[model samples]
Target: MRARFEKQLLTLHQELIEMGSLCEEIILKTFKAIEKEQLPNTKTIATLSEEIEQMEQDIESRCLKILLRQQPVAKDLRTVSSALKMVYDLKRIGTQAYEVSEIVAQGHIVKSKELHVLQSMVDSVREMVTMSIDAFVHEDEALALKVIAKDEEVDENFDTIKVLLVECFASKSLDIEHAIDLLMVSKYIERIGDHAVNIAKWVLYAITGQLDIDGGE
Candidate 1:
């Protein structure tokens, strides 16, 4: 019975990794679409989104099964609960990527200095998402903490974009619609980083047997 329970836990872990990888792919492709000023490849994004949703459902079902059949306790219970939370975070990240793709499809292209800043910000968050998941898979508390710490950088870049966007709106130098779309794009990227932080928190919970709301606790 113990061996069977461990096997189920491993299955859950693998499914989480698959879902995280799909979300990362969507984020990278969405940024590529933005950089090229082309409509994002929605077909791929849609397919991945569907796959992620299915994975979330599968993970939830398996977690419930484990709770009922095995009655997981202590660290095992934390692992199952953390897996549930991580799937939700991954699903939100996927949604944010889809939102960005929709903005790209609307023919909004942010150019010049602002575009560079936005691209850099996207790249940072993408890296964070990848690192946070990797840390969880490897059970590396240090890497998980690093993911949480990097949120500040994402926030700073987001602030810079907001200021530039406000100035553009005030000066009437850029199309207001375009500016708002770009602002939303920045916001989506920032939210992605926030989701990555949430994943890091889950990783910590799985490892330390404690929950930290502030991430530093």
Candidate 2:
């Protein structure tokens, strides 16, 4: 029974990693659409989003089954529960990525300084998503802490983008509709960073059995 339980746990980790990869891919597609000033195929983004949602449901069912059949204890229980919570954040990240792509498809084009800051935000956010899942897969608390710390950089980038957009508005360089779309995209990116932080915290919980919202600091 114990050996089977362990195998199930490994399967859970593999599924989580797969779902995280899908999240990363969808976000990158959105970033490319925005950066290159090209309209992404909305159907492709929608299909990715649907796949993410299906993964979330499948993982949730697996976790529940493990809990019912294996009746995990202590750290084992924590690991399974953390994954159940983690999938929700993963789903949210995928949903927001799709939303960002939709906004870009609607002719929202960023340029110059704002684009540079936005690029930094995308890079940081993608790293956080990847590292958070890595931390969970390896049970590495330190890496999870790093992902939580990185959220600050994403937050700062959002602030810088907001300031630059406001300045453009003041100088009559950007119209209100375009400014709103850019702001919406940045806000979604900020929320994705927050979701990554949540996943990292869950990683710490699965390892230490304590959920530290402040990155264990």
Which candidate leads the pack in TM-score?
2
Model 2, total clashes = 0
lDDT of 2 by residue, 121-161 (tens): 99999999999999999999999999989999999999998
lDDT by residue (1-217, candidate 1, tens digit) is 9999979987887888888899989998888987886778888887878888888888899989899989989888888888888888888889878878888788867566778889999888988988988888788999999998999999999999889887887884778778888888888898889889999999999999878754321
Model 1: lDDT to the true structure: 0.85
TM-score of 2: 0.96
Distance from true position, residue 118, model 2, in Å? 0.7
Candidate 1 runs further than 4 Å off: 214-217
| Distance from true location, Cα of 124 in model 1, Å | 1.3
lDDT of 1 at 180: 82
Q: Provide backbone clash counts, one per model.
A: 0, 0
**Alpha carbon lDDT of each predicted model:** 0.85, 0.91
